[model samples]
Target chain A: MSDAATQPDSYPVTDRSRVKRLHERGRYDHAAVHAILDAAMVAHIAYVIDGQPFCTPTAFWREGTHLYWHGSAASRMLRAQKPGLPVCLTVTHLDSLVLARCGFNHSVDYRSAMCFGTAHIIEDLEAKARALDAMIDRFYPGRNAELRPSTAQEIKATMVVGMEIEEASAKIRSKGVGDEEEDYALPIYAARIPVTQVIGAPEPCPRLVDGVAFPEGLKGFTAGRRLDEVMVESHRTTFGVE
Target chain B: MSDAATQPDSYPVTDRSRVKRLHERGRYDHAAVHAILDAAMVAHIAYVIDGQPFCTPTAFWREGTHLYWHGSAASRMLRAQKPGLPVCLTVTHLDSLVLARCGFNHSVDYRSAMCFGTAHIIEDLEAKARALDAMIDRFYPGRNAELRPSTAQEIKATMVVGMEIEEASAKIRSKGVGDEEEDYALPIYAARIPVTQVIGAPEPCPRLVDGVAFPEGLKGFTAGRRLDEVMVESHRTTFGVE
Candidate 1:
């Protein structure tokens, strides 16, 4: 089920991890890689079967150098990603759209992390539950204590996979446009259109109990705060940012 | 460069396109598939090289069931994704985070589209230029005419690839959580935290010419409007929605 040519091994920037297009924007350190992963809510996971590639979007969590994702036990995608199988997990954030004086120069400011690794299914009940709890607490701090514990049947039906990042790189483009020298003299409206994810006011479930107040997790919440900031503050701990 | 096993064949939910985990959420029709593709700004493109999968996030535009993306001519990823090579492109939007009474029931509301297809390099200069114009106009309507035309050198340095979608499906989960029957009585704070991408005030370049007024595209713009709606409105005319 494995091919020597397909296996992923961690090296600096010489092999598949190298950034050829814009080498200046590439970062090969763990700090840069971890920061992007921690700030992202979802990852686009790609795996191959019978030479056909499939990219699926799912929520993921990171602890140390390992990333974890859980899904239904019967999922075909998850089942295909067993231990020693190659996988690529990618996370991206579109920071803004840059309109330049020349069409060729128009671009976007974005942060993206690409990780290559091998998957190992987490079958131990205790370890699985611990990872689940940590994931919940990471997204909604102190939330695990308030929620009902997972039933035996629920645990039995869930499957979690751990991927140790073997080789990873972060690519970022945060500056303004780079227009051609001749185009800067033209009469064009060039600017940066800032884009960010925002969290709106919490809407309680219709079946919520009559006196259930907003939980401590959402205190002082407003509609305009950046989604990245809200997620970072959810656990009051930093992950990938320096 | 093409293999029979790697060829993307169009079929309705019977073979590879079927959504096995949550079958009820899958849509096999072109209307659903096109709607999701039209609404997304970026796509996670996955392709296999030497049996290894690489998922790269890039801006994509869809026109008449064909998806197009352009990049530097020297891109290694693009070189490997030549005509007849299998590819998968996925687009996702995170609508909200659902907090359920049971941890197992917690999930996010999302809209995602998975497309399977074969890639073909757009070598015709006229078609390439037209696609590029449609892309720029789609993102910033009526702004292309005002900008300086792309130089021949710039066009020659860029490579455009088109992927004809052979099989595609859209999966959406829009409602609240699905808690177990026994967990409703718990005193947990369950709610939906709405997530949206916001486009803030445009910041003009400090070197912008004097008297360059705000373009007509952003008139009456509000901050709270959903990013999907804004992107759809950027290129007027609707698809799929009743």
Candidate 2:
């Protein structure tokens, strides 16, 4: 059985996180929600400041049911979000473009997660430092231990925020086009164009130390491999989860 | 001279749309903002409903200074956004991962645009139809002409919304890693791993009509090419601008 079936833990459906349209595509299970969040490198965080909504794109990682992100301490978005701000964090991966015989049936395949939570800054210095290292290790497992340690000033200037997901939903559309029955007989061509984010050739920094080889931790980032798949694999490697 | 320099039009810096941190990376010119928006297919739109913020990922297109997106008529988001709802629309493209010698300097090269405006449903049927066709042509120039025309019922089932760009800023970080001068002497390996979204081999639908050849309008979508580059080219072709 799949992990979701075995565990079967799910978030309770609240009015906010419920998928009203196309309800069949919505998943509230922990595995479904975590899988979508873990595969994405960036998340768009939405917060309201004085009645105006702002969506800021930031790098984020997931640990257990909590989502974490960091930014410069002086950032306006980060400063506003530090005081237990109600926010919605969303991550989306566009898998493919589905072309149909008619404009009405054209669609794109995607996996998306919308998580609602109250974000608060991580105030403890040691915990913040560990979270920072965990963020790096999530992308490149065990690489943080090899790098220069973060200076006190560096850690102080950064702000880490964590949000325990109160409610969440994962919506996925991974199928081929589903057109009206009679429309398939049309002479128009139909197909699915796959979309993928891939890693390109690595470019070494010009000032790299003489004879310093490529880091072993980043070996998972091979060229031509899908980035989301690699990120999921890296997350598994870091967290020791299947 | 570039188009932005010649035209010299820009969105007024509003309190909400202004880039507060690292202001040097912020751009207010039309060319800079439009280029980032046109190159992206999905936009995270932030909206507030009942004091809570929601960020939704939707396929979006740009025309002139306005942004457009459509969804099912029954979608809760569309229903809530139809009556001049305030929104922040953001598009982000992750270019590369910048691995510096220290965690403090770790960053991602990205191009992002955040636009602030009020969204309202396109109520007129004719205008909505034209906008829908324009959206299709934006991604696949001239493809709409080959497809079966949208029936009235289909048009009625879709909700198209447009938001005029009232305030906007584009932030871009495209350069190599900038480690601390003293840290460059460390023996740690540092490099940039480029990230790209690429097009893969097209998969033909099993029920395609016999002998229906590939459409000519989709020739720009070649395998192994960057999806954003192709999208930008397609936009230029459809809009007839450089």
Candidate 3:
């Protein structure tokens, strides 16, 4: 019942977006693409400068049909990406290690997405400010209003860029370990160790002032919930299923 | 103590490897670089083909003084990477989400490493086989002997590549949230939600034959341990701490 399974609009597969090697795992719908993008907190961004490819890991947020990331105004990554250069952003979540009966069949179950587009710098101050607020509110709901208003000087020192997601695709593998039929009969253990990101109890900053308590936004937080579950749930409650 | 803290030889700070922004967080010793690289299960690889940058996610392993990854012989990533091309391999672990009292100070605690080098395609059959075996044993120790040996065709259809760590650096941020002095009095929850990968109960495949019990290596595994702890512990025991 996930949106990715029922959404009607699908991304058109291009030569670059196509999953040639494992076509069976490729997904081309908004549900699949957005779910993967929204659940991931970090995206490895790839861009070329003078024929040398550089992959920089940075925090990213998705708004509407575009993806955005922010960095220092003087950063080379931001400056190079501001000119609408071609870029590829990838996010991956390792679900588990699949230990098969044989070494060849061993693999990791994972969910990953690749988004290709040209990034354009957000120039309007108002829009940039809103983007920054949205980024904060995405992680900690109602947090922007709780914090101090950003100064104009602070905004000027940050760079926010957006990409239209020209072509995107997602691939997922979440099944039990598959071993050769013949090897399954061997006296060996074949099982998958499920891996998930767990959020621990919140550790308050030592410099906090007295009488200030955990806000309403953090009351529902639990330590045992999966990272993606918390993220996807927050997105749904905030955005109303897009 | 971790090797990164005690190692004497450091990676030369090249123009490409230098961390300009937040240089205080940069670490060039083996302990820092290898610890991040070893703990991360996946690495985002960046390379250029016809001037276009492609970032692909693949599992990676580290051995001695080099990092290694393998894929199908026909995969574009493997094929393109075999000719000793300049590449950037980045491994990142999202440690936690830092909810600062202010929006500007909000950040994610993470450990990341970026390696710059030319990838040499592993051609020797014996070496490649040993590398493959090492990869399997790295993830699931003491299981290689129980599985069937890889055939010649299977060996020929896999491409293994190694990159000497010419220049690499690790960046880490693990402290509690830090917000501006004025914002500390705000009635907001300013804390860190520690994130760690949890290993869940082993799920046996449907094709698992009867009477096969779990191996000794897996019996001693616990679900609550951190991914890095398990990986580092395994590495320590398998090849006594360097």
Off by over 4 Å in 2: A1-8, B1-7
Model 1, B1-242: lDDT tens digits are 11222433322554676787898898767767776777668899988889888999999888777889989888988888765679999999888889898789899998999998898889888888877888888777777778888878878888899987777888999987677776776777888888888777778887888888887866523455566777777656322232
Expressed as tens digits, the lDDT of each residue in A1-242 for candidate 1 is 11222433322554677777897898777767777887777999989987889999988978777999989999888888865578999999998888898888999999999998998888899998888888888787777888888878888888888998877878999997778787777778998878898877878887786787777765634676777766656535423333
lDDT assessment of candidate 1: 0.80
Task: Pull out the clashing pairs in model 1.
Answer: A35-A240
Better of 1 and 2 by TM-score: 2
Worst 10 residues of 1 chain A by lDDT: A1-10
Candidate 1 TM-score to native? 0.92
For all candidates, state DockQ relative to the true structure: 0.73, 0.88, 0.70
Model 3 chain B poorest ten-residue lDDT run: B1-10
Q: Compute each candidate's TM-score over C-alphas.
A: 0.92, 0.97, 0.94
The local lDDT score (0 to 100) that residue B213 gets in candidate 1 is: 82
Model 1 chain B poorest 10 in a row by lDDT: B1-10
Interface RMSD of 2: 0.7
Clashes of 1: 1
lDDT of 3 by residue, B1-242 (tens): 23443446777777688787787888998878888887767899998877778899998888866889998887887778767788999999888989887677889899999998888889999999999988877766677887778888878988899999888889999876978777877766788888988788778877777988788765545667677767766655555566
Q: Going through the candidates in order, what is chain B's TM-score? A: 0.90, 0.96, 0.93
- Which ten contiguous residues of candidate 3 chain A have the minimum total lDDT? A1-10
Cα deviation of B140 in candidate 1 (Å)?
Answer: 1.3
Off by over 4 Å in 3: A1-8, B1-8
